[model samples]
Target: MSDAARRTVLGAIRHHLREARSAGDELPAVREAGRGPPPRIGEREDLVREFATRLGAVGGVAWRVAGIDGAADCVASIAAELGATRIALSDAPLVRALRGRLPASATLVEVADRDAIASCELGITSAQAAIAETGTLVLDAGMERHRLASLLPRVHVALVPVELLVADLDAAFAAYATREVPAAITLVTGPSRTADIELTLVVGVHGPQALHVVLIDGA
Candidate 1:
């Protein structure tokens, strides 16, 4: 879309918001009037288990490791299992540790080009946060920055810190409320999949077919 078009749409949204507020047409729900309070995950809930279980339910794989070292090992094993000869990686501190760890025949790559990303069978990146309730990986998106690596490969490996896990979207947004607005936030729930064809299910239609998450607690 053109900049003018974008601005027009944004202006319309702003006008709509102003009109709504002026009209006071929307009702605010209050817990005092019998409505229950918003739901939240238990404070003592095991986030690791919850995240992993929820991920599996949506066709994503998750592994809990002790720290970055264990996560590196897990990524190597997973790559080997899939017979991956080339793996694309983001320049994340933790993911970069796997550079020299893959099998001698396999290569670990970190580049921003499409051709470079396409050559790799697996892609590795890090998440800003992981939502335990819905098993989502949230990334701070930029214009095609790290998009090719994650979206072009057959398999995607995401390294996320366990401490960054949130109970739900509400909690996720709350954490960012005090921070400056991000350019965009990408929420990945599972492997790229769509069944828009003649009812035949398809995977990797627009992104990676397999999603693997490595959660590091000690990082």
Candidate 2:
């Protein structure tokens, strides 16, 4: 671009800023802070229900359970639905309960070889938090095992406590503001899908074919 064109663009931007300031539209604090309040999504909607609706719209499944016991029941039902006789498992307490409820023939592989995990029909782990606004589950992969189990299987099942549900992404991050940063963090809003080619939606293109979240009441 020519020098004259660059100056014209700068002049237009400065003029706009001046007009905005004069109209009292300039929020210096928020601008300096580099962030502001997120858009309100749960103002009139029930958060839990909203989360489920959003999740379903994205081709993911969600179930709200009474508590941990209900979660175990839901896990069993999901296992039957998927015809999964073997599953990769995590060590979280919520995950453990699901493991215990599996049938005698169903095996839970806690310490798995990569090939075994990839071959399993499903994988189960617990979410660090669930965002109601976008139906996203936040996973802190501080323990390396959870990362592999959540990703290697054909289906990824997440058990999240009701108390861990937050109204928005900001609230979710605020809950862990004081915690030490993990080696990795994953935010999953739905099942792995892509529509990049000819706008044809394909599930399980890069990750699990299915993503299920069972929300339990007890935290």
Candidate 3:
């Protein structure tokens, strides 16, 4: 077509698109079905266990630890039992403490390189908080640094400080909004699972196949 004709056609198309977009009806009102149940708060230890249990119910496992040494021991045992020799770790102080404790045979990963993650057997990191009601683990990505490292591996381990546990999603959201921009925030509920095809349950299809939560009592 001639240049002037093409311009006229494009202009008409753009106008039509704008009109169609503006013609959409308003969305329906959203209302809570009922007043929600009272929010439940737990002691740090209990919150950790609750998070662990929730993950476990969805096929993930969790462990509670007393301190640094305990965290190392926990990782070592899991690596040994699961025959995992490679692990990815966030560049955080508490996780760095695990350096001395990891088995020499176990290789440590610090960055979030995709190949490095795929080669590794496990990924380990820390989180910003744990939401009990939704069984979610929150990660302030920039704050945590290696957020991708935690999500991109086959097996993932987290060293959760007890004080980071919150009652529910709302509280978690409030905490996040008031805090500094975390770079990236991830709310991981369980091992990645999907039933997209023929209603078949598949685990690790979208993300890590296994999630191991290490809720440290006093880190």
- Which pairs of residues collide in candidate 1? none
**What are the per-residue Cα lDDT tens digits for candidate 2 across 58-169?**
9999998888778888888888888888899987867877656876577778875888777788899998888888889999887445787888888999998877777888
Among these predicted structures, which one has the highest lDDT?
2
Compared with the true structure, all predictions reach lDDT values of 0.81, 0.83, 0.80
Model 3: CA > 4 A from native: 1-41
Q: Which of the predicted structures, 1 or 2, would earn the higher lDDT when compared with the native?
A: 2
RMSD (Cα, Å) for all candidates, in order, is: 5.2, 6.8, 5.9
Candidate 3: residue 12 Cα off by (Å): 16
Give the per-residue lDDT of model 3 (tens digit) for 1-219.
699999999999979877876899454556866435545666766776677778788887777788887888998888787787787888888888888677788888777677887788888888888887667889887676766777777888888887888988877877645677755788898899999999999998868898888888778
Q: Could you give the candidate ranking by lDDT, starting with the highest?
A: 2, 1, 3
- TM for every model, in the order presented, reads 0.79, 0.78, 0.78
Worst 10 residues of 3 by lDDT: 26-35
Candidate 1 lDDT for residue 37? 45
**In every candidate, how many clashes are there?**
0, 0, 0
* Candidate 1 regions with alpha-carbon error over 4 angstroms: 1-41, 142-145
lDDT of 1 by residue, 54-89 (tens): 999879999888887798789889988999988888
Candidate 2 lDDT at 22 equals 92
